[model samples]
Target: MTRKTVRIAMNGVTGRMGHHQHLVRSILAIRRQGGLDLGDGTVLWPEPVLVGRRAHALDALARQYDLEHRSTDLDTVLADPAVEIYFDAQVTSAREEALRKAIAAGKHVYTEKPTATGLAGALELARLAQEKGIRHGVVQDKLFLPGLLKLKRLVDGGFFGRILSVRGEFGYWVFEGDWQPAQRPSWNYRAEDGGGIVVDMFPHWEYVLHELIGRVRSVQALATTHVPQRWDERGKPYAVTADDAAYGIFELEGGAIAQINSSWAVRVGRDELVEFQVDGTEGSAVAGLRGCRVQHRSATPKPVWNPDLPATEAFREQWQEVPDNTEFDNGFKAQWELFLRHVYADAPYHWDLLAGARGVQLAELGLRSSAEGRRIDVPEIAL
Candidate 1:
């Protein structure tokens, strides 16, 4: 097979998501697996050039990954004729400028979601990408999860005859740095820095609901900063301006109602840090990141409600576990492979900049809904 090498300029690879998920787990994993087979007597290999602002951090990461290419000058990397792709996983506020620059430089673009800080910025990026005719996409990694895949299979097989509702519970307590080091970054609590639970998580809910259930028509939300102040990485106290928790109720196109709760201040009492419960006429399912359990109407237990009596029913054991019929790869890597195929082979890819713009739209509307104390209608993006 003929081998083709594609150079990718990966910006912000020193960050947590970029370094662990995109670089080490996805890109390097693909390299270890002998590249992607195009099935046309050709294979495409990805060569990533680590790009970041900090010289010391970039040097450390490059040495850790044993990579030959590393650059602090983003303009130099972007101007390189050999570079075919430009990926950004930087902080939310910095995304648009870098992406716009990359698009202007004629590089195919991809990035992590809430694609931009606002709806207008996201739409502008999408429009520019379309006008430039550059291949682009945004990460919707949850769609590739094993549990969601099983849920999709069940939905396809008619297990859920006319779905009714979906409830998603996500989050865990993040310790303040005063006593213990905060698990998340300090920027996440500062509104000026583009940090908030609504902006960070509503995009995930939008895609999940749209893919597994139906399109969201409207949203009613209430968001709050549960922890008013917290210590930063340097042990200095800082006011928390961004919301740490968001409670949302969404109406889908098919009359299915979806409710999602995202918080960085909540304690965990469920099976996983995140879980989704879907109910339907024929059956019901509860899915986590890696596991899914289902209960058909036929197998549901009939129990009389007696508050004063001791309950003997094993409610949790009534549901059956979904079998893992196929081996599931890393969700980030799976999407990376598909994106590469889309760029190289012109494969059908739906998660474009337009889709990313829609995610930004959802987050923006969700915040408005919370502030106005009313439901906000979600309009489709024309682009």
Candidate 2:
């Protein structure tokens, strides 16, 4: 097998998602498996060049992992002729500027979404990347999940004949940082600091909906700061300006109504932290982060609504679990492998910077709808 080395300059690995999912689980995991096979007797070897603002953290990570490269300066890493890719997992507020710099430096770019704070900024990044003629991709990790993949399979196979509606429930209670430490960063609650549930998760739902069911035609949302005050990492209280919860109603292109509720204040009562149920004339399916279950129309149970009587039907047991025909790797890792192949092999990759801009567009529209307190039509976006 031929070994082809590709150097990737990774930024923001000190952060949790950046460190845990992208770096540790994805990139390093590939290296441990003796690199990714690109077929035709070639093995794609990824060399990570860790880059971040925190010098001490970067140094510590490099030393701990025995990584040869670590840099505090983005410009220096960008200048390196050997580095082929620039990967970002930075905060949403800081991503656009860094991406602009990377594109100007002529490196392939891959990043976490929301790619920019606003649709305009995201479009600029996409346009700039296109002008630079460099390969670019944004992480759509959830699309690669086993459950969602199965849901997509059902859709593609026409199991959902004339899809009617989709209901999605996501999120769980995040600690107020008083009684227990908050699972998320303090900045996530500050609107001025690019923190809000609308900006955070709407981007995710956009692509998921478009790929699984249909394109969103319009959006109506209510974004609210359910938790008014919360203690920070320093144990100091601060006003929560951003929304902790959002309820959105989206009209799909094919006339499917989709409603998704995202909340950090709500406690879990479902089997998974996030679940989406899609109903059609032929069948219905419940999809989560990992599991997908389906029930054909013929097998659907019909029960009379009787409030005075106890429900005797076993509704939960009616749906059959979708079998995993093939091994499912970590969603993050799976995407990383495909991206690597995309860059080296120039294979078909659609989730480019433009696709990322679409996510940003939906999020921006959702925010606007919340502010105006009305349903807003989603305009077509172009570079």
lDDT of 1 by residue, 284-320 (tens): 9999998999999999889899999899898899999
Residue 69's lDDT in candidate 1: 93
Alpha-carbon runs more than 4 Å astray in model 2? none
Local distance difference test, candidate 1: 0.93
TM-score of each: 0.99, 0.98
> What are the lDDT figures for the candidates, one per model?
0.93, 0.93
Cα distance off (Å), candidate 2, residue 191: 1.5
lDDT, residue 303, model 2: 82
Q: Residue 323 deviation, candidate 1, in Å? A: 0.6
Model 2 lDDT-worst window of ten: 339-348
How many residue pairs clash in all the candidates, one count each? 0, 0
